[model samples]
Target: MPAPTRALLLIGPLLLFLALVYVLPFLGILRWSVTLPEPGLEQYRAALTDPLVRSVLWRTLRICAIVTVLSVVLAYIVALIWVRGSPVQRLVVELCILIPFWISVLTRAFGWLALLSNRGIVNGWLQATGLTSDPLTMVRNEFGVVVGMVHFLIPFAVFPLASAMRSVDERVLMAARGMGASRARVFWQVFLPMTRAGVIGAALVVFVFALGFFVTPAILGGGRSVMVAELIYLRIFQSPNWGLGAAISVLLMLAVGAMLAALLRQARPGGGS
Candidate 1:
């Protein structure tokens, strides 16, 4: 066999697996969006024009944006510590971030619920310290949802950011400092510009991941702050509106694709997008 043909045969099984598991299911979703309920783009039209759908999309985008921003900020801090701190501090911080990876998403979501519920540990501490008499409403709302998402997404943001930061030539930083640049000036002008790609990459990743969240939002929001994923679940399972659910899923896929495409288009071989 020719070399190119042998290479293709070597990866054929993996390609077939992806086709069966991913490609077929995606095509099924696209088909349902147009074919069910008498077809002719009704579902797509409704998805675009319906007020309730619009509200849910807006809320989903808004919550995801918030989670992304918070995750980036916190991840930047964590990544900085991981890259710049003493060896012991770096080990501790990295372990703390990675520990959550071992825990299942469902477990983490439930853990947040246990900690953030009105009568949970946080409120108990506040009350005991005389901070407030009434229990604060934390869980089962937008605030709780954002907190859980940010916590879950910070690690995702951190890896890309840390990679970006590590690739920076420390000699450049030294040169800037040696040239009489102040600490703040060095960081704001020299260091940050070097890590620009990482920051944007981290933010993009967090935002995209947050956009499709289901379990955490469902558990934390408790139906009060429904996002796109939860709404899709309700539409498909509860209301039995598979067509509408598929439409929303397709729309979401498109939105994510657009972001990824824009990133690819703007990204350079050596610089930030």
Candidate 2:
């Protein structure tokens, strides 16, 4: 068979699987968003105007933004270290970063719960040390949610950055150093600009992942810090408002799609240059 035909044949099964499992179900959701319980825009209007939904959407965006920013900063630092470190140091740091990615999301969230809860490890230690009489509220709040999300997102941020940093020429830094440039100057002027693509890519990845986060926020928020995903769950499963749930889901999908489109446009040659 021709090379192009052979490549398509190899990918055909995966495409079929995606169509069956993803495309069809998503199409169903779009249909239900408008057609269920009578065809109209009532569900969309309600989702847009509902106070609870507005609050949840805002909270989700806020938390995602915080997580994305924190993750990118921390990951950049780690990736910088990884790129500049010795082979042994690189291996150890990479293991530490990748180890968490192997664990299940629910497992990691529960681990945070145990460590951050009122009577959890940190609070217990604080009380035992006579630092405070009462356990401080940590888990089941925005703080806990951000902590979990940042932890989860850091690895994602690191990989892209590490790849980008590896592409940076060390000779450029050597030239700057030989010219009597300060270390900070070399990093700020030469290194950071070279990593812009990685930073943007990592930020986009973390933000998108954070927006769809449900398990971490649900477990950490304790009903008080509901996010968009949890709100969708409640609308669909708890209240049986399928139409509204579908509408919210569609909105979320559209928002994510728009972001991806913008990112793609910027990525094109001379598009954002």
Best by lDDT: 1
The C-alpha stretches of model 2 lying farther than 4 A from their native spots are: 265-272
Q: Please give the lDDT score for candidate 2.
A: 0.91
Predicted candidate 2 versus true structure: per-residue lDDT over 174-267, tens digit per residue = 9999999999999999999877888887888888888889999999889889999999999989998999999999999988888778668656
TM-scores, one per candidate: 0.96, 0.95
Clashes of each: 0, 0
Per-residue error (Å), model 1, residue 145: 0.3
| Regions of candidate 1 where Cα sits further than 4 Å from its true position | 263-273
Best by TM-score: 1
In the predicted model 1, the residue pairs found to clash are none
Tens-digit lDDT track for model 1 on 184-218?
99999999888988888888888889989999999
Clashing pairs in 2: none
lDDT of each: 0.91, 0.91
lDDT of 1: 0.91
